[model samples]
Every structure is written in structure tokens, then in C-alpha cells.
Target: MSDKILIIDDEPGIRSSLRGILEDEGFNVQAVASGEEGLALIKRENFDVILLDIWLEGLDGLEVLKKLKEEEEKAQVIMITGHGSVETAVRAIKQGAYDFLEKPLSLEKVVVTVKNALHQKKLEEENLILRSKFRNKYQKLVGESPVIKELKKKIAKAAASKASVVIYGESGTGKELVARLIHQQSSRKNKKFIHINLAAIPEHLLPRELFGYIKGAFPEAASDKKGKVLLANGGTLFLDEIGEINPLLQIKLLHLLEKGIIEPEGSLEPIPVDVRIIATSQVNLAPLVRAKRFRDDLFFKINVLPIVIPPLRERKEDIPLLIDYYLDYFSLELGKKKKTMTSAAKKAFLNYSWPGNISELINVIERFVIMVPEDEIRPEHLSLLVEPRELQLTPQNNHILSLKEAILHFEKEYIHRRLMTNGWEVKRTAQELKVTPQELKEKIRSLGIRIAD
Candidate 1:
């Protein structure tokens, strides 16, 4: 958008002329006669630049400027002074005025000042964006658990020093998050953190993806293009799923780690880079090395400071807190009212083993919010979960029970146990129990198991 400019002056001619000049220069200009009106405008709208006459009918220019700054209105203000007010102008300049121009204002000087102020504003905005990115990139790594605390400590330690790091974690355990946190807190925070998922890219194109390919280097080469290693120069390059990378590519990565230089695909010139290599893997490194699937030399090179993240099931205590965090997040994001998991539901959640860990829990919570009726989430609100028949039906005097009652009790126990085992996955439970879903539903209904809610 064109920069917004507010022209505030008691002189009618000055206001009109300044507005015309600013509008012609592609600014959104608004003219006000008094500093009072200008202050009101500042309160209600966002402006890029403000030109305030030192003398005004209501609030004085300096008073308005002070008020604007106090209100934290982020805009550049240039004070306009009358002749023989050099002292006043000097004081205004000291009080955060971008520039002081004498009245019978020069149009050229006005335009030039506006341009410079807007350019400075642009730089401020760019700096804000960079800071925001840094904050956002590490936001997912939220928690003060001992594990997380130690992980942050390790990240800070490794980031402060120039060392190769090997992040070890199960899939969906957020290994990438640890990698980003390290880079953001490091000395090289100003530079790039280029990430390449080794397993995601094709085997044949891995070399070209890591190292830039020159024009006519290969069959599809129409132009020279830079690769991640080159783009991530002076910063860090994170190789994700390092266990899946081919042995030859491992050698190439090892070469870069060892020599701090890489020869791009189909290029003879070796480009020197000061990139900190951070590699991650979900697999056990020792088994892979023993099997000869991974090069032992490369493993030793990248595994300088290893960080292991246990699976989600092992960290059940953090699940409830994670649920609250995600609930708040999704509520804001989806524009829904805030909700919480009921105690019964929380009990069911803790009882179930999360094979996919935090990732799986997040998915279940998302589904629960979208599907569960009413404002509160109950145990049955989790459609993703199933229950054993014993938990479903209560029976006394086992021998004295009728055949129909016995069948009902047995069905309830079976269904509830399967549900607990499968995290209440009804369809999977049905399939596992060798029963049609419709039959299972009927049985659950017949035993009043479906009436829990």
C-alpha cells in the first residue's frame, strides 16, 4: 500500500499544498486543521508519516507529537517551524522529530523527508518480520519439562559453539523443532537454516538437490540453480531422515562436514562453505552401521552432540498440558470457544498408548473438537476410542445369570477391552474382533453400552 501521510497545520494554504504534494508522490494524504484533530486521527488509524505545524489552535504541535509517541503510534513525525524558531525546532528534533523544516516550507524538502522517513519505516518493518520469524520457528518447542529443559540447554550449548549435531528422535517427536531452536539461538541466527529431508527427495536427484547444478549439467538442466548447501552458506544445513540417505550421498555429506567444501553436481569448482551441519534420524545408528547400511565414518562425523527424544507414550505426564496448549491454539485459530477434556476423557487418554506419540494425540484432539457435541468433551466424545464389554456392562452372580445376560456381559467386556486397546477405534476394534461393524453397533446398543453419554 502507498504510505499514509497526515498533514496537520492551522494555515489553510500550507495544509492544501502539502496534501497535494504528498498525494502526487503516491502517499495516502489526509489534512487536518488542528493538532487535536491530528491526534484523534492517529488514535483511530495507522499512518506512515505525519507533518505537524509547531503552532496549532487546540493542542500544540509538540504536545500532539508527545501524545502520539506516548500512544505508541508507529509513524515518523516531521515538525514544521515558523522563522526565528530555531531553538524550538532543535528541541523538537531532540524529542523524536524526524526533521524540522521552517515554514514557507520547501516542497522538495518535504517530499525528500517523507521518502527518507518511509524508507526507515520499511527497515523497521523488515526487522520486525525477522524477529517474528525467529519467535514463531521455536514456538512449537514449547514446554518446561526436565526433558525439554535439558534439550534447550543442549541446543543453546551446541548453538553457541561451532559443532556438528545429530538430533535423534522417533518419527513425529519433533526432531526438526530442536534443530530450529538451536539455529535461532545460535550466533548464525541472522543467516539461513536450510532444511533438506533426505528421505523425501528422490535417490537419483539427491546430489543435485544438495549441490547446485549448472546449466546443461543434466538432461533437464535449462538454467543454473543453487542447492540447499550453497543457499545455507554461513549458517546451517539440516539433513532430516539422515538414516534413509544413500551411502554415496552420506559420503558426499561427510566430505562437506570434513572439508567445509562441496563440488556441486556436474561442476568442478569446489565452493567453500562455513555451514554447521545438523543431521537427524529416527533409526538406531549402531544397528545401521553394523549392517553396513550407513558409513561408520559419516556417522562419527555427524554424531558430535547427540540429542535423543523419547516417544510420546513415555512422556504421558506432558499429554494433558499439551492438550491444553493445542486447545487454546485451535480455539483461536478456528474461531471456536475454548474447551477442555473432561476427567473421564483424560483418564481414557492416559490409559491408551500413543504409538504415534504427540502427533497422534494432536490428531485425536483435533477430531474431538470438531465432532464432539456440546461445549465439554466427555469420554464418549472421543469417537476415535472404543471400550471393552466389561467396562460397558455390570453383572452380579456370574453363575446365576441368564444366557442372554451372560452374552450381554461378555459382549460389553470384549468391546470395552478392545476399545481401550485400540484407543477406542471402533471400526478397527470390530475388524480385530472378527465382527461386522453393524453387528458390533447392534450388540453395543443391545447392552446399553452406547448409552454411556
Candidate 2:
């Protein structure tokens, strides 16, 4: 974005001259007559840099800077005054003005100071946005399940203290979500929330990436760069898929945890960092530690507070609520009408083991809503059990049929054919027949169509 410059001066000549110069340099410039007008303009819009004149008609430059600091205290300001003095310059700097300029101002100094101040403002804005985004991304753990409630309580308990947390769960169980919640609830929420996927980064790069590197640290090093740990100073650093890290890096990680310091690549002196570590893994880290694949010291350092996310199958009671959540999400995301689950469909949802967990459920639900044009979801719509099972029309059937003789035969054929058309998933089958899982199961039972043992 082009830099926006706001010029506040009493003299029309000064305001016009500054605007012309800034505009020529490709900056969007706005000039106000007095400090009062400038303050009003500030309230209406955001500016990259401000040029404030010291001796205005009513409010002096110092007064304008003070009030501006009160509103957006971090704003970059360059003070301009005809009566330039050492005391005035010192006072301006003390009041958060970036630089003080004595009139008649050199065009070069004005341009250079404004450019540097705008660049500084841009960096600050980028850092603020990244921090805000990181905080908001972790605010989506919505559930009243006992497991979730206990998890929240635990996060609250651990957030205040400087404890390393380790989260363990299967794939798609929201392990990263749990890790972030811990960071946000902590006292360090306002600080950076740095995240890295251990599995995603290369083994050779992981060390430099986590601990940071110095200028000319290696052949490819153009300049010094702060790593995730340094970025997360005074906050939390999340190491995702920690179990997948290389064994050598595991040892280095242990060293950092023990020392509370990191020696950048090619550096001997260690840089101290005040950062809490939150590590997450899809598999149990304990086993890896025991096997010597992961360092035991590192595991202990990161396992102060442990959280495990139960699979969707284990918490079957929450399936209906999860479905509703996904339905609402997909409706808004796909721009479609609302979808509701029928009683029969809910039963089918309850019966099946969600092998892929919540992620799988979301994908299936999104497709189910978009493809199947139905007001309400029935039993056949619930894609609970997807594995193919051959059910023969035999007398000795476990699921009792609701019909008798020829009607039962026809119903059996109808259900079987529909299952074939649906590729044999309970959810798809229900959608094809415009029935719920409960209805499908009931009809299959009523007709004595049985799964062959």
C-alpha cells in the first residue's frame, strides 16, 4: 500500500508545500489547517506518518502530539517548529515523537524521516496482524462434552504457570487446536504465538529454523533471522508433529529446554529466550522417547501438562452436535440452505465408528448437504458405517425384517439395490432412498435382509 501522510500545520504555505512534496514521492497526503482539524482527520482515518507543527494558533505542537499519543500512542510523528531548541527537541522525543525538525526544513530530511517512519509503521502493523491472527485461530474449540470441558479447565490451570505442554491425539483429533488454546489462555497471550510443524520442515533446516541464525551464519545466509523460538519470546512456541522430528534435532531441542538459551547456527554464545513450549503429536510421544527415537530429556521438558483428544468414536454421544456444527459451517461456506437431521439419520450417525474422526465427518457432511437436495436428513443419509457388507435374503437373520413374505422380498430388493447404487455406505444409501439411517436400518430389519456372516 502507498504510504499515507498527514500534515498538521497552521500556515497554509507549509501544509501545501509538504503535501506537494509527499505526493510527488507517491505518498497519499492529507493536510489540515490546525491541530484540531488534524485530530479530527486522525479519528476518521488511519495515517502512516504525521507531520505536526509546534507553534499553532490555538494548541501548540506539543499539545497535538500529546493528544495524538493518547488516542494512538504508538503513532510515528515528526515534529516541526520555527522556534527550534534543544529543550523542545528533547521534549518531543520524550513524548514519543519519532524525530524533531527545525524550520525551514530541508526537503531531503523531511522525505527521509517520513519514509523511515512509514516503513517502521508498516513493520509494526504486520507484526500486530500476525499476532492477532494467531490468537483468533485458536478460539474455535466449541463443545460441551465432558472431555472438552475438562480440557478447557486444564488449559486455564496451566496458562498462568510456565509449564511445557504436550498434546497427544490421533490424526484429525484437533491436537493443534488444544495447543493454541493453552497459549491464548496463558499470561503471554499478548506476545507472539509462533508455530512450526516439525514434520513439515526439513531435518537440516529445523535447527536453524527453531533456534534462529546470525548474519553470514552459512553460505546462503543473506542476513540475520530470528527463529520461531525467538519470535515467540515472552509467549508460546508450538512444535506440531513433534514425534516426526529427526533424532539429532531432538537432542538439540533437549539442550535448549535445559539451558533456556539457543546458540544460533555458527555462534558460540547462547541467546536467552523466555518462551513456553507447547508440543503436539498425532501418536504417543512416550513410546518414541522409550525407543530412543525421541530424547527422554526433551520429552520431560515438554510434557509438564499433557492433553489427549479422544477419537469421535469414543465420544459417540457428541456425534449429533458435531454433525449440526458441520452442517451449519458447510451451509454458510457453500452458500446453501440449512440442513437438518431426521430422527432415523441421527440413529445411524450414533451407530457407526467415525474412523477418520471429526475431519472425515466434516468432509462427508459437506458433500451430503450439497449433493443431496433434502430439507431434512434421514437414516440413509448418515454415512456412519461405510464398509461393504453382503446381506443375503435368508430366514435366519440377526436384524429382524419388518415385512412379511412377498412384500418383505420386494423391500429387501429395494434396500439392496439402493445400497448398491449408493456404493454401500449407510449415509449415501439413505440419501438415495430419501430415508434416514434409522429408517434404512428399520426397513432392512423389517424385510429380514441380513448381513451374511
Candidate 3:
């Protein structure tokens, strides 16, 4: 079917001209003499794009746009008027109008704007479908541990409400996963769930990235840019590592939370948005607030619904279950038979503190599935992967060793652990260890540590 276009103008000539133009462009066009008629027709049918006139008989274009938004209409509206101003255009955009146009209308500009609006509408629909499918694929939170059960309860509660949430957890403890689960189960599940890592973005560029900017906002800004916050309007914005946000940005964020509006760069107009913030942080914000690094008001605002995820070390009981699940999952994913671990190796895994948490465990399991040829993974196979903290050193033995021997022993163990964590990449491990690769190679040779080719 051809794309449908609805024209709402008080002037018969303008309506007829727009209808003719759109119809000639292969659109199924409908013309109405007033906004009232256009709205009535919208109630009866669906249109891909609506060409609305600012000056109407009963209801004006802005009022109609407001009604369309209130009704949650999917059609993209392009507002047109013979008398147009920057204020009017900003007002139309703030009220969710796709684009603003002036009359005597440039027919070519209308066609291009309408096509762009239709294209955007199609992309949004496709995104919703894709998000639905993704939500269906990974809806459940794994593990039957008591902490996990309690976490699930909190998640369900958070989902049922439209409150800001701050998820506190260590790195790799699935903070993002929990955030996504909350978004998936929330009232806004059908809308977009945009995730922005505050830590990943440079501090200088963060405001523009989150709040967007108008055309020519900066030297490099050649066109208008929609930020993640606007993109997540009527949905959830997952601010990953939100603790990394600077003091200035925090104030802006606080303003957004307090007032449901954001001012794009280079524009005085503040666009109203309905965005629920779901922020994840590995660090506690209280200390940052006390230090004056983070805004206290902002912290309190976002901490309305605080959900703390226990690190894997605290929930060691879930290790076996996670191991089984990942083993089965990675085995199937890698097209290999399921692998089993010896009781001793499992004991070592449970004993070792997984500083990297669930993510580290997953990496180790995946590595084993790919590298280990045998179905039965033994303690020796885990030697390089698992840190030797499992082997407790007696106080008497420590006293027997000299200072140099103890230093050498600790250095070797630490280097080996770092190597294993970095997949034995000498360059990466050296960078992390703050040493030159050549120096690390010398240490590795002197220590007689074996590395896989």
C-alpha cells in the first residue's frame, strides 16, 4: 500500500494543492478544511504523515499536535503556516511535531520533509518490533539464590512504578543486565531503552551527547543532533556508570529530573520530554556528594528507587548454578558437547574471589569450552585461570622464606594472574601492570612461567 498523507488546512486552494502534490508523489492523500475534521478522520483511520496548518477554523495545529500526543498517535505531523516564526517552530517541535514548514510552501521541501518523517516512522516501528523480540529472548533473571530472589522482588517493584532507579554494583556484576530487566518489565517496555555510558564518553562531549544540539551549535556541529535522552522520550534512559558524570552535567541532569525538559545546545527553547532514568554505578555517590564532586540533589532524585546487586563473591552459593548455566549455554553456542568440571576444580572456583564477578566467570567458562579438548575439566586445567589464593600459605612457611623469595613469589603469582585475566596478551598485561612489554618478557622468562602460543 502507498504511504498515506492527511492535509488539514482552512484554505481550499492550499489543501487542494497539497493533496495534488502528495498524490502525484504516489501518496494516498486526504484533505480536510479544518483541524477538527482532520482529527475526526484520524480517529476513523490511520495516516503515515499529517500536514497540519497552524491557522485552522476550530482547533489550531499546536492544539491538534497536543491532542495527537495525548492520544499517543503514531502518525508523524509536519506543521505548516503562512505566518511562521522561530518560536512557533520551536513550540511545534516541543509538542512532538516532526517538522515545521512555512507557506507559500516550498513543495519540494514538503516532499523531502514528509519522506524523512515517514522514514523515521518506519524506523521507529521496526525498532519497537526488534526490542519486543529482544525482550522475549532474555526476560528471566537466572539463579535461585536468596539474594537473587530478593533482587528479583525489588526489580518487580521498580518495574511496576514510574520512578527513577539507581542500580549499585561492582564491575561485571550485571548492573546493566538488571537495568535492562527493569526496563523490559516496566510500563514503558514498548518504547525505546537507550543506554549511554557516561564513563565511555569524554567529559567535554557528554552534555551534547545527552542533551543534543541544534544545527551549527558548535564548530563541528554541521546539523541538528538528537541526544540519547530525547531518543528515550516516553521510555527509559540507562545511564551506565553515572557516577563518572561531572558536577556540571549532574546539575543539568538534576534539572531534567526536577523539570521534565531539556534545552538543546544553541537553542533557548527547552523541549519537554518524558524520560525515566535508570542509572547504573559501580561506585557509591554519597562519598562523591560529600566531596562536592556529585550534586546531592541529583543523587537524592535518582536514588528514589535504589537496587543493590550483590557481587559474585558475596553470593558464592550461586556459583555452581551459574557454572552449570554458562556451561550449557556456551556449549550449545559453540556447537560443542557440554563440559563438566572435577569436584576439586569446582571447589577452587568457589574458593577464589572473582574480583571481576559474573563477567569474569563467564570469560573463564567460555575459554575452557574452546581450549579444553576433553569433556572432563580437571584442577590442572584451571591452574592458569584460577588464582593460586586457593592454596593457603602457613605463617611458619612465610617466616622460613627470605624477603627476596617472598617478593619473587608474590610478583610471579600477581603477574600470572594478570596474564590469565588478559588472555596471556603480554602487551595488554604489561600496560595494565604499568611496565614495558620487554620488562614483562624478562620477568616472565626469569620466573619460568609457561605461556600458550
- Which candidate should be chosen as best, given TM-score against the real structure? 3
Better of 1 and 2 by lDDT: 1
- 2 versus 3: better TM-score goes to: 3
Task: Provide the lDDT at 79 for model 1.
Answer: 90
- What is the TM-score (0 to 1) of candidate 3? 0.62
Q: For candidate 1, give the lDDT.
A: 0.76
> Tens digit of lDDT per residue, candidate 1, span 416-448?
656654555567778998989788767756655
Question: Each model's C-alpha lDDT?
Answer: 0.76, 0.74, 0.82
The estimated TM-scores of all candidates read 0.58, 0.58, 0.62
Task: Show model 2 residue runs off by greater than 4 Å.
Answer: 1-138, 333-335, 369-375, 378-453
The true-versus-predicted C-alpha distance at residue 55 of model 1, in Å, is 46
Q: How are the candidates ranked when ordered by TM-score, highest leading? A: 3, 1, 2
Residue-wise C-alpha lDDT for candidate 2, range 100-185, written one tens digit per residue: 78888788889999988977875885688565654442346757789878877887887877888888888877777777677767
User: Could you say which candidate leads in lDDT?
Assistant: 3
Q: For model 3, how does the per-residue alpha-carbon lDDT over 11-120 read when each residue is reduced to its tens digit?
A: 98898888888899999898999887887666545578999888787888889999889878889999886763657867899889998888878889988999999999
Instruction: List runs of model 1 lying over 4 Å from the truth.
Output: 1-138, 384-453
Global fold similarity of model 1 (TM-score): 0.58
